[model samples]
Target: MQSELILKKDVDLHHSQDPYRVQNADEIDEDQSIERQLRFVLNRLTPENFQKLVINLINLPLNTQERLNTAVNIIYQNALNEELYSHLYAQACKLMSQIKVPFEHVSSKFISFLSILLKKCEKEFDTDYHKDKYYEYLVKEAEFVTDEQKRKQLLDQANEQLEKAKQNYIGNVSFLAELYNMDLLDDAILHEGIKRLFEKQEKDEENLECLCKLLTRVGPKFDNYKNKEKIDDYFEHLRDIYEKRFSISARIRFMILNLIELRENNWTPRHESGPKRIEEIRNQVLAEREERELRFAQTVPQTQIEFMVADGRRYSLFYGYAHHILDQLKYREDFDRVLGYILKVDPDRHSELFEALICISMDKSDQQRDLIGEFFYQNLKSKVFKLDQFKMGLRKVLLKALESYMKGYKFPKKLSQILANLIRLDFLDISFLKDAFEPVKRDQLCARIMAKTLKLAAEQIGCQNVSDIFELSGLDFNYFFENFENEVDRRDFFKEMRIEWVSTIHEHQRQSVELIQSFKEKLEVIFRETGEEPLAVLDRIEPEFHKEETKTKEFIRALSVVFFEKVLHHKRIDSDKFKKMENILVNFVKEHLDLQLEMLYSVQVLAFHMKYETNFLPVSFMLLYSDEIVERKAFFKWMNNPRGKGHGIAQVFLSSFFEHISRPQTEK
Candidate 1:
C-alpha cells in the first residue's frame, strides 16, 4: 500500500503543472543517483539552464583536487564545444599585454593542468600564446583545490572564473571607467535590484551601500539609464543619507548646485533628453529637506583666494559656484549671493552690494525672479522689516522713509523717485519710497522712469496700495505752473491744464482741493435742515466703503475747486454764488440718490428722483455710463420727448455720448 501511495505521489509530481517539475517522486529515494543526475543536467545544459546552475553555485567551496579536476573536465569540454574557451584565450592575451605575468613556468605546471583536463575530457584545439595564458589562469585557480569537495566547488565556479578573467582584461582603464563598465554590465540587474530595494519597506543597508557607491561614481551618467526612475530614486535616497549622515552644508551645496546646474543649464550626460533629465534632477533635488541646516551641511567651502589670478580661482569656491550660476544666467542666485554678502557687511558699507541688488532686480532675465525673491529676503529684510512696522499704523512713516531715500545725495534719483512713488502707492513699502526720493539729484523725473519703477514695485510688492498714493506727493495740483489775470486767459489755461490733468492722473492736485470743497458744500446742502457737518456725513459712511467714497469726493471737489478757482481769478461768474449753486446741485444729488440707496424704499425714491432731476444726468453719465438707466431705448425715447422732464437728460446724454464716441480714441 505504501509503495502504491509512493508511486501515486511520483506520478502526480511527474505530471504536475510546474514548469520545473522533477521527473518522479520515487527518484528522490536514490540520493547518490540524484547527484549523478545533477551532473548530467549540468553537462547537457543550455546557457539559460547554465545560468540557473550558476545561481546555485554561489559560495560553495571549490578546493578539493579530485572534484576540481572533474569540474575542470566538465567545464572545459562544454567551453570547447561552445567556443567560450577561444573567447577566454583571446581575452587572456589582452590581459597579458597589460600585466607583466612572468613566463618562466609556461609549459610546466600551467600546461600540465590544461593538458590533464583536456586529455581527461578528450578535447583537442589549436594552441596560441593566449591559449597558453588561459591555461596558466586555470592552473592558478587549481591551487585552491586540494580535495574532492574543494575541486567540486572550483568546477562549479568556472563561470565566475571566466567572468573574473574578462574583468581583468577590462580593468586596465581608470578606476572610474572600470566602474562605469561594471555599471553597464549590471545595468539591467542593478536597475531591477534597486527598484525592489526601494519597493521593500525594509531594505538591506549593505545593498544600499553598494548602490550609493555606484551612484556617486556614475553621477549624472545614471540619467542615461532606461529606467531613469530607479536612478532618480537612488539620487533621492542618497540625498536622504547625505542629510542623515553628512553635514547640512554639504547637503545644501549638493542640492543647490544640482538644481542650478540641471535647471539653469540644458544639461545632458547619462540622460538622453534635456528636459527629462532636468526634470528628474529637479524632482530628486526638491525631494531633499530644504531646511537651512541641511543646506549648510551639504555645502562645500567654495574656493576663497586672497586674489583671483585666474578665472577658475577668482571667487572662493562658493564664489566660483556663484560665478558658474551667474554665467548660466541664474540671476536670482546671483542676486541672492550678492545680497547675502552685502547684508553681511555693515549697513554703511552695503552701498555697492545694494547697487548690485538694484541692478539685478532690474534685469529682465529669466533668473531675475529668483534673484529678487532671494535678495529681498537677505538684504532687503532690514529695510522692509522697519518699513512694515512703520506702515502698520502710520503710512506717512513709510512715505517719509521713501522720500528721504529718494532725496539722498547718492541715490539713483529717477529710479529712486519712481520707486518711492510706487512704494507710497503701496505697490512697495512706503519706507522704500521715502528712501528712494532722498537719493534723487536728477533735474527731472520723467514718466518713463516713473513707469519703470512702478512696474518693478508692482511686480515685486504688488499693487494693493497703488491707488492710495495721493497723500505722499500731494498731487500735481501745480497751481503755480502758470499765471493769468484775464477771464479768457484763466479759462484757456484751465482748459489746457485739464487736458494735461486728464492725460496725467497724478497732476490733478489743485483739482483735488476743489473736489474736497465741492463735496463739503454738497454734504451741507444734503443735510441742510439737520445741520450735520461735512465730517459727520463722512463718518456716517461705512469704513469699508469710505476710502473709495472719500477719494471720489476729493477728486470731484478738486476738479470743481480748481476750475472755479481759475474762473474766480478771472471773474468768469459771480464766484460765491456760482459755488453756492454748484454746492446746492451736488447736495441735491447726494441727498436724493447717492446716500438714500442705503434703504430699499429710499432706493425706489432715488430711482424716481433720477428720472425728474434731469440736470444730474451729466454726473450720472460720468459715473454710470450706459447704466444711467435700466433700459437704453426707453431712456432714449423718454429723453427725446420735449415735454418729458428728461429733456435736459437727453441733451446731456447725447452730448456725453457723442463726446465719448466722436473723440479720438487716445483722447478718451
Candidate 2:
C-alpha cells in the first residue's frame, strides 16, 4: 500500500507546477516546503499520539521513509500559510524541545519546520520575540542528533540561526553564563558569539583574550578587575617555570610590566613576599605535574618530547626545592653549580628569577645582612657568562646591587672602585644610570662617571680626549647634543676642550647648489636651439634667455644668492636678490614648467630651508617675519578666507603679480 501511495505521490509531484519539482528522485525540496506541511499535520496531533507516530516512523520501510519525509516537508510548507504557520511553528518548537526525537529523518524534518516558523514569525511579528524560543529548539536539536556529520551540520545551522535571531535574544550576563555552561558552541566561536550576544548587556565574559582586550579598551578602568587572586591564578601556573630559572630575563618582562602597570596587581604575593612567594609559586606549578602534564602526553610533538622532558625534569627539580636548596648552600661553590645549570639550560628566564631573589634579599637584609651583596654579585656574574648580548642587563643588575648595598653600609673603597669602573664602562647608556642613580646627589657622581668614561673610551681607542672619542666613534654631529646638555657646564666643557660649537650643520649646502645646477642644465639643453624671436614668440623655438651670457650670469648669480646665502645661511643674501631669483624660476616655461620650476627652485630651496632650521640656524625664517609685512600682504588675506579663495588662486596671483611684473626702471 505504501509503495502504491508513493508512486502516486511521485507522479503528482512531477505534474505539480512548483519550483521544487524533482527532476530526479533526490532533487526535491523535501525539507524547505513539503516537510513543513507534514509537520503542521503532526502538530494537530495529540502529544501521546504524536509520540506514537514518531516511534512508528522509525521502523518504516525505505519507500515509506521517503513518503513520510515528503509528507513532513509538505506539512512544513503548509505551516507558512497565513492560517497555519504560527500554530505549527509553536507546535513544532514545543515538540522538538520536549522529548528527544529518535529518528534522524523525523528530527531533521522537524528542525526544518521549526526554522520555517522562525522566519515566518520574524516576517509576521516584525521582531525577534520568538528568537529565544527558536534558539532553545536549536540547542535541543544539537543534543538529539545521532549522525556525527548531521550533528555537526545541525549544530552549525543552529548557531547560524541563533546568530540571525540574536537581536531577539535576552542579552544578559546570565544568558552568556548559561550558554557557556551548555557548551554547544566551539570555544573560539562561543568567544565571539557570546560577545555579540551579551554586548547589549554591557557585560563581557572574562576570558584570556577578552580580559586582554578589556584591559586595553578600558585602560584606566583596569583597577576594577585587578583582583589579587585572579592575578595569582594567572601566574600560579608559570610560577614554577619563572622562579626555577633564577634570573630576571625578558620572558616575564611583559608579565612584570602588567603587574607594575595595574595598580591592583601591586599587592600580589610575588610583589609582597618576593622570593618566598616564588617558592609557593613553584610548589603550585609542581602540583600540576600529574593532572596537567599528562594532558599533553598524547599530543606531544615527537621531535620536542625529548627536549621537553629534560626541561620539565630540570624545571621541576629547581622549582620543587629552590628555597630549601638555595638556603642550604651557604658557600659560593654550591650556588655557582646550581646557578650554572639554570643559566646553561634556559638563560632567558633565569634573569627574572634572579631579580625576584634580589628583591627578596634587598627586602630582608636584617636576616642575612652580610651575604646579600656577595650572593647578588655572584649571581649577576653567573647570569652574564657566555652571553655577550646581555651586557646591558648585566649593567642594570650591577647598578641595582650597588644601590641595595648602599642602603645598609658605609661606602667601601674597593667596592666603590669596582662600581665606578662598571658605571664608566656603560656611560654611553646614561639613561640606565639616570634611572638607577637619580634618587641621591648622583649628578656629581654622574659628571664624574661621564668624565671618566669619555676619557677611558678615548684612550682605549688611541684617541686624545672626549672630542676625539666622538670623532673616532663615527657618531654624527647630533651625538654631542644627544649626550651633553645645552647647559652652562656643557658649554664650559666644550670651551675647555677647544671644540667648535655651532647651532647647526650646513651638511648639504654644496649638494643643494649642485642639484639646482643639474635641473638648470637639463632645462637649458632642451632649449639650446636658435632662430627664435624673443619678444614676438610666445611659443619660442629657442631658449628664453635674452642674449645668453647676460641671462645665464643673472640666473646663476640670483640662484646662487638664494641657494647658498639665504637658504643655506652661509651669509644672508639681500632679500631683493632672493625675490628676483624666485620670480625668474616661476616665469620659466618648459614642457612641464610648474613641475620643472618646483624641481629646480622651490624644492631645492625647501631642502635648504629644512637643513638650515633642523641643523644649522638657531632662528627660523617664520620667526624672522615682520608683522607689518604680514598685515599688508595678500598671503594673510587669503589665509583668512581659504574657502573663498578660488582653486589655483595663489599660483594665479603669483603668476599675474610676481611673474609678469616688470622690474624698476634703472640704467638699461
Candidate 3:
C-alpha cells in the first residue's frame, strides 16, 4: 500500500471525543484512558496486523530498562515522519518523566534524541560537542561511500566541511583529508599533501602511491617552485616505476595539463625550443587519447584484462579492478553506450555490475534513489543477485530504502522483491521487525517471507529461537488473564494459545489434563465463595491451598488456578477471619495483581502497612498496640471522611482493626 493511501484512511478513523473511556476493543477491557490513546495511535499508524508493533510497546508498562531501550529505538525509526514523530515523541516524553528512573542509566541514544528536540524548542541549533558525537556522526555518513571515486567526491567536499567546522570541531580538516586520500591514484589536488608526506622520515612504504599522485597534482606547480629540472627528474623516476597504476590517459592528461599550466604562467624556458617542444607533445597526446576514448566508448573490446605483477615475474589477472576508464568520460551518451554494453557482455561479475550502477546513479543530479533502484530492477534483475559476503547490502540497500520511504520518498520502481530477498537471508532481525513491518505491507513478497519465517520459528528447538515467534504473535498474557469483557472470550483465547504454544515449544507434549481436571474441581468451590469484591468474605475457609503454586505450573497450568486464589496465606479460626481478610487485601497490593480489586486493595495495604509495618498496631486495633500516640486519632479521622479524608466504604475497610498480623519479613 502507498503511504498516502494508508494515511487517507487514517483520516476517517473516527475517535471518540472522550479519550478516557475504554469500550471493549476486540473483546478486551482496559480501564485506563491510555489504552484508548494507544489504540488510536496504532490503528492509524499501523497499516496491518504485521506492523502493529506500537501495540506491544504501548501494551506493556514502560517501567523496565529493556522496554525503554526498545522505545528509544522506535522513537528513532518514527522520527522519519513528522506526524508519527510528534506522536511517538510526545508519548515518550511523558513516559520518561513518569518512569522517574535515572537519566544516565537509560540508553544514551534516547537522551540524545530528547536533547535534539529540547534544543529545537530553545532555538539553539548548535549542539555542544561531547562524547565523540561529531566524529561518530561523520563515520556514520562515511559508511554510505563505496569505492575510491566516491571517497574522492567526499574528500573534495572540503568547502562543506570548512563551513561546518567553523563551530569548534576537532580534526575536521584531517577527517576530510582522510576520505580524500583513501585509495588515491590521480592527483587532482596533492601539492600540500605531497609536502606533508615528505615531512615524515619513517614513511609507510606501501603508501608511496600518494607520492606518485602528488607528482601528478603538483607537477605543473613545479615551474613556480624554481627547481624545474630537479623536480622533473624526481617525478619522472617515480612515474616510470609507480605511475602504471594510473591510466595512460590520466598520465597523458597530466602532461597536457602541465603544458597548459606553463602557458598560463607564461613561462619563458631557458632553452628557447623547450616551450615549443612541450606544446607539440601536449597536442599530439590529446589528439591520440581523444581518438582512443571515442573508439572504446562506441564499442567495448573483448579478451582485455588488467593485471598486477609481483615476485619478479608472476602476474594476477584484474577483472573489474578499474571502472576509472569509464568514469573519465566527458559525454553522457558515450558513458551510457559503454555502460549498457558492459552490463550485457559482463553479466557474470555481480560486484562490477553493482559498481557500474552505483557510479552511474551517483553522477546523476536528480532522483538518484529512484533512478538507481529502477535501473537495477530493469537491467540487473536477470543476474540473480545475492547479498554481499559481509551482508553490508542489507544496511546499504533495504534499510536505506525503508528510511527513505518513511520520509515519503517515492521510488522509480517498487523494490519489494529485492527487499524480500534481503529479509529471507536474515538481514532484518527482531529489532527491525516493527519498523520494517509497516511500509513493507505493500510488498507481497516480503509479507510472504515474514509469514513463512514466523511459522518455522514457532516449532524451533529449546524455544530460544521462539522469542521472535512470541513477539510476532503479539498476544499478551496479562491481557488474556484479566482484561477481557466477556469471560468466555478470554478463557477460550487463553486456553487455545497456551496449549498451542506449550505443545509446540515442548515438542508435542501437552500438559497432564486429567490432573488439572481433578485439581480444578477441588479448587472451584473455594474460588466461587471468594467473590470479586473489595475484602474477601473470610467467614468460609482454612489453610486451604493445595500447594505453593510455584514457578513451573504457575505459567503452563490450566486456567482454573487464578479463580479463587488471592495472594494471602489463610488460617481456619473464626477469630482470625478478619486477619485473613485484611491479609488478603494487603497481599493484592504487594503483588500488584487483579486490576478490578487493585485500587480498593491498595488503600488497605498502604493504611495498614503505615500503622503496623514499623513496630506494631494502629490506635483502632489497640492503644497498647499504638506505636505513636500524638496523631493516631487524627490519622483515623482524616482517613474516613469523604470531603477531606477518602471515599466512604473503602476508608472503612482500610481503618478496620485486625487482632493479629502475618509473620515478619526477616523471619520469612
Cα lDDT computed for each candidate against the true fold = 0.37, 0.36, 0.36
State, as a TM-score between 0 and 1, how close model 1 is to the true structure: 0.26
In candidate 3, the residue pairs with backbone N, CA or C atoms under 3 Å apart (3 or more residues apart, or in different chains) clash, namely 1-442, 527-564
Q: Which should have the higher lDDT, number 2 or number 3?
A: 2
Best by TM-score: 1
Q: Over the full model, what C-alpha lDDT does candidate 2 score relative to the true structure?
A: 0.36
569: Cα error in model 1, Å: 40
Model 1: residue 510 alpha-carbon error in angstroms: 9.0
Write model 2 residue lDDT over 1-668, tens digit each, in one string.
99989877735435555566446646655443444444544555532233234432332221233454454344334333322122323343444322222245553222332333334333422333334566678778879988888889877877777655432222222222222333322244333432443342223112222233223222232233434444445445334434453453553435534544453544343444213434345444545653354455446775553322332442222232233334433333356555554455466655444433333333222222234334444444444533232333334444664566633332322223223223211112223333333333233333333344444333322122233223323433333233455567666664554332322123322444564465455334433432212222224313444445323433443433333343333544345444433433333322332233232233223323332233222121221122111122233333233221111222222332321122222411
lDDT of 3 by residue, 1-668 (tens): 79979777746667888777654665564324444454455445421221234434444554444444444444433432333224234444433432322244632222333333333322211232332445455555666778867766555564345434332221222222322333211233334344444443123332243343334333343444555555565556445534453433455445534544444455433344413333235444644664465456446453453333222321212222223322322222244544443434334454544543343333232223233333333333333343341133223343444454422322322332222222221112223333334444344323333333333333221132243223333432232134345657545643543433422343322345465565456445544666633244323323544324312232113221332134223311132333333443233223322321223222323333232232222322333123221133344443333221112322334344421222222433
TM-score, each model? 0.26, 0.22, 0.22
